[model samples]
Target: MSCFENIAVEDIQSCINAEVPSGISEVNMNYAVHADIATFPVPLAIGAVGYTYAKANVIEEDIAFTAGKGFGKIKVQVNTGELTFDGVGSVGNMKQKSSLSFFIPSNDAQLLGFIRTRLNTPMVFAVPERQGQNRLLGDKFNPAYISEVKGTTGKTGEDDKGVQFTVSSFAIPLIYNGVIQEPAIIP
Candidate 1:
């Protein structure tokens, strides 16, 4: 019943050598302010079988969100979106810090309004990775927040002009196993 007990060592001998695609193709953004359910995620119980660090840190159950309370899908540009994890393994705090970065091409009044609302809102981001894996950042306990938003109108016609968003959270991200249901954008 000890949390520090040694579990079976995982073996990587059967791993295959193959090229895997990188970078996020899309991000599902969920605002905590608009969520009907509480933001805190259900924590996994200790002593559960096959409870690894990756599984123990995140909720393994599917999240059911009502209409208009579900995630909003954002398509990321090629090579424009990525999530990074940084953590300290000290005894005092073993928490991990994760950051999600992506660019939204083009800027309009409607987009500005949406960006305004994100500045002060708590959020959760689900990013799709290779091999049909969905990675979730920001649980209920550690909701993500917009750390920075940089917009630029390029001087040259060929230069990129858009807004880049950096969403960050102090909680370790999870490998999502459930489907991400998108809410109706117009409803």
Candidate 2:
């Protein structure tokens, strides 16, 4: 059996929520937040065959990507110096240090809650078929699923240690929260 079977959807949702830091401000001007459940450590193994013992330990980092127009101008305060904007853009290549937040609706929240309730249950991360310009499909083509549970498991004890999990690519999807009074326009 695979270790993924031990994980529930709710566990993944909790990991997503836990990934979001506290005291952060949600995008309330003209944007919304949408989250999807992600699977890591593909082709997982629970020790050996016929054993209740499973290693479900994982680490998830906060994922914050830029959205909307003028997202590059978003400012974030850091100690004595404040990080300001040098340009206006989305989650692509831009130089700005802003801590923006996204919100979820009650229905999505309920769904996430339900997913969380299924942690430690037998589960498997599905690998979808790839056939387009979409990077997600390309990722699905790769069978390696790096778990974020450890920051140093795959790295050598050196100064050049790298991250274990694959970095999520950026996508510009329109988010709707029914909270924005108007759309944010960049000039």
Candidate 3:
């Protein structure tokens, strides 16, 4: 049995554009898998036995926008999973830990550029709710909110690929309420 047996394509599409702001000529969203820490060692060892394993499961949705004059934003959300580890031997054992984190900072210009460039094009994005609905959708789904442009690429020391944008604003549809709300700084 499939979980999406009664979902309408239009309804799903509607959810996609539910957060687009007014005056924005166009909007788009792309989904991608940002796998981090594919396998990490668990801190569990005994006697002469040792074990290590790490796994990261995350589904990211990248929302792109083009409100004229190159002014746009990319909002990404991550659904994370726990880390698993196991080790059993005559003289050894193993352990591991996992966490889910998705928060983008507000001063990463390079990361913003990278996302805008990669997600701006047309590509097949995965729909987490309905895995069978994996299809190519242009960057035009408006979200109910544009949380923050965060980075999950992890820390790279001096390399610092861990830059992200903390999006605290979003554009919702007028049908849900009255007039559209103007952009206000989130404190």
Candidate 4:
């Protein structure tokens, strides 16, 4: 005999009208991956890795909206906050200040390899955005170097699995050229 109760239909896909917003798919996060070694405290190898700013995780993005109480108050716009994105990475490799115990800093292969060497080290602070959506979200802010280093030995829980690395860096806006990255809203 089957030892089971009634089977409920799961993973359902429904269609909505144009006015209604579609369900969320997945959020894409972007981190600073650079080719240089000067960004760090110690001398990283020729293959420094770019730290993953976030995981398939949660970021505490706080935004408040207010209206202007004047004679010509018509709409509500973002009057405060220059837009921010902060959270923990599953790896916990990036910190606000410089660290001495991290493995990547000591190991040349780890330092100058993979994510570290491939990430774009910006000159200033900014959020990543797609090339097409820059109009509404503003111009390409370029993921510049805005205090995206320095980290501590955080927990190893990991994102989408457990919890661990907490972000020491500040959140920046995402200005992509085509695809939308993490810490952003396309809908």
Alpha-carbon lDDT, every model: 0.71, 0.24, 0.27, 0.25
The lDDT ranking, best first, is 1, 3, 4, 2
Model 2, 41-150: lDDT tens digits are 22223443433322222112222323432211212122111111133356565532222221222233443443354222221111111111101111112221211211
> lDDT, candidate 1, residue 139?
76
Candidates, ranked, TM-score:
1, 4, 3, 2
Model 4 residue 109 CA deviation (Å) reads: 6.0
Question: Which candidate leads in lDDT?
Answer: 1
Prediction 4 global C-alpha lDDT: 0.25
Q: Which ten residues in a row have the lowest lDDT in candidate 3?
A: 169-178
Give stretches of model 2 more than 4 Å off: 1-107, 132-187
What candidate 1 gets wrong by more than 4 Å, as runs, is 12-16, 26-34, 38-43, 57-60, 89-92, 184-187
Query: Residue 88 lDDT in model 4?
Result: 41
Better of 2 and 4 by TM-score: 4
TM-score of each: 0.81, 0.15, 0.19, 0.21
User: Runs in model 3 with CA error above 4 Å?
Assistant: 1-110, 114-130, 134-142, 151-160, 163-187
Question: Residue by residue across 125-163, what tens digits does model 3's lDDT show?
Answer: 222122222122111232212223455544565443444
After TM-score superposition, the amount by which residue 67's alpha carbon in candidate 3 deviates from its true location, in angstroms, is 16
Lowest summed lDDT across 10 adjacent residues in model 2 is found at 129-138
